[model samples]
Target: MRKKVVALVAVLAAAAAGVVVARGCSGDGTSKEARPANPNGEKPASGTSPEDAPRPMGSAVTIVVDASAPPSEKGPEVLFSATWGGSRMNELGRSRPDEANPEAPMSLAMDAKGNMFVLDQVNGRVVRVGPDGKPESVIPLKEQEAAQDMAVTDDGKVAVLDRFNSKSIVMYDEKGGVLGEVPLEGEGLDELGFVTGVFVDGKDVYVEKEHGPLLRIGTTDGQPVDRTEVPGRPTRDGLSYIKAGIIEPEAGRMYISSVDRATMQHRYTREIRQGSEIRGILLLDTDKTGTIYLATLLVQNDQESVVLSCHEPLKGIPTGTAVLPVNTMPEETFRDMAVLDEGGVVYSVRTEQGVSYQKYDCQ
Candidate 1:
């Protein structure tokens, strides 16, 4: 069984300097200009603030689908669809907000057997939804600052990264039994910033702090092992930290979303430095062949997202890739996304209607 993998933002530079500036990427036909360094050195405002950011609202939602595109070449097909947590009443005669009261989904992971573990950040619990798209079980963790991200293992063990607490990663068994907890302090804790990502590969668990040096831990005993620096750690100032990462252990490579900086380098690279219009990267694993699926968000240039397929690796420049847009509503705010073994991509979005999950099939 392969546990669910969530997109992790790379913690770098700004963190070392203790700043959170929303420096947009510039490349791929766009101008490469440096954002001015904050003089006072205070944290800069994000591109979108909480007040202006998109959120699920109202009592109903309108879903649109483009049926003309084929799943294989154009990306995943939406085989089945389900909705959760909204103001509208569900089959149980309870409004979504009243039933589960789920906040925006922070992170999610899926096992090889098609089981999904979703971190309901506001609720502080892991909701496991079966292949049928029905809620199977709910595992709650009490009294934590924030349950940020989660990953599942092939053997059915789930690991969660909870921020603000002394210990960061907590593991759980299939029956919701407590396995163990790993404290995210020591070594590069200060420079690494927060526990941005938790990945389970075979018997070893990979924990990513804000910057570089991804930590390896024992999955069975929860013991820390060697730490290796991730590819593309900046050597000087003016460079940006990693924005997000998707681990494809089987592929022997992890895809990292980063700023448009030439100084940074990675071990195995697939980049889309198409300027700020490229919002983020979403990774999906196909059950058909276990190949990694890469999707880049193009919010500014187009209202939809793009799915890319490339066989060759490029050093710096963007590749001539097959790009297909996944049309999404303008109001939808991508919270988190996970890839299913069957080449299906499941993602969470906050719309004016409410937070909900949607699945798209990939080839």
Candidate 2:
């Protein structure tokens, strides 16, 4: 492959100065842009200075879809026709079945090629939609009755988590071929009920245990590993692991912390004081360049909205923020937001008609 003329020119300029600058991809075949990651792994003090102040912004909708049943080519897909499709809520606004949420498509994922995978669990299939908002194909999962969340690798491999009924994680190839299925219980994981989300890094499969530690359960081939665990969620670049928490819940203050993936040493913990009534954090993940993306559900004046904040890599420096509208008209959903390898996010919302997947460039 021929190098870009601009890259070659840049290399020559650097070499003329008696220094050879090497080009390196961040393990995703894309060059890692020079980011302001702290070189000394300094643990910056947060929540007390202007550097840790929050910067919030709003997001513009990129895609919208009306709900439709299977065998249709016009939608992200939904299953609201049957009597068992609705989730029951009481006067106190609590689900009767406890953790068994609802029948909507609980999760969504996107491949490196910008293809969307909607886990239509109620319909028993994974709906594939391209970046152009066109339906591509369907990956059927007839046996996943209570699949909670799913993650897709950069190469279009999929790992579906069915923690309730199946207690298993099923792996699938790009063509919807069954690679393997493995149990969730292992060394770092003990209870299936506490498993929160599924994540993919390289060939390894990790399941977040109750929003805490991530237990490396298996691989892309659907075989269980020997029960290794990570302290937090691994970034796509495989260089850092990040964990986030809401410290002053009432004041909407939060902190994002990370450690080096190799040495597991402290990197930085930056606190952000969001100027909204934050209900909770909705999403947290990184792009291929390790740029951090966080979504928090903010409520003010009895209205709830999702506020997205973008930060630079492991340093946790604020880049920008945006507000994503939340579907007040609730359907049963387990996962909503998915980050892209190229610094964007696509999230799904289920309505009375069908599920609509929308994209936002909060990064």
By TM-score, the best candidate is 2
**Alpha-carbon TM-score of each model against the true structure:** 0.56, 0.72
Candidate 2 residue lDDT tens string, 11-120: 12222112111121222354421111110001111222334322221221111111111222342222112123432210001122556643556777888998878776
Alpha-carbon lDDT, every model: 0.43, 0.61
lDDT of 1: 0.43
Q: Give, for candidate 1, the lowest lDDT window spanning 10 residues.
A: 33-42
What ranges in model 2 sit over 4 Å off? 1-101
Q: Model 2 TM-score?
A: 0.72
TM-score, cand. 1 vs. native:
0.56
lDDT string, candidate 1, 1-363, tens digits: 011111113333232112111122222423221111100001111232224322211111111122222345433333223344432222111123544443455676788778777666555567777777666777766455456667787666888776566366777888877777776666656633445467665666666544223566446446566554443222112233233232321111223333324555432333222322434344422233323344444344334334332221121212122334443433211125675655546655444344455665321
Off by over 4 Å in 1: 1-103, 191-194, 211-213, 218-221, 226-276, 284-290, 301-335, 352-356, 361-363
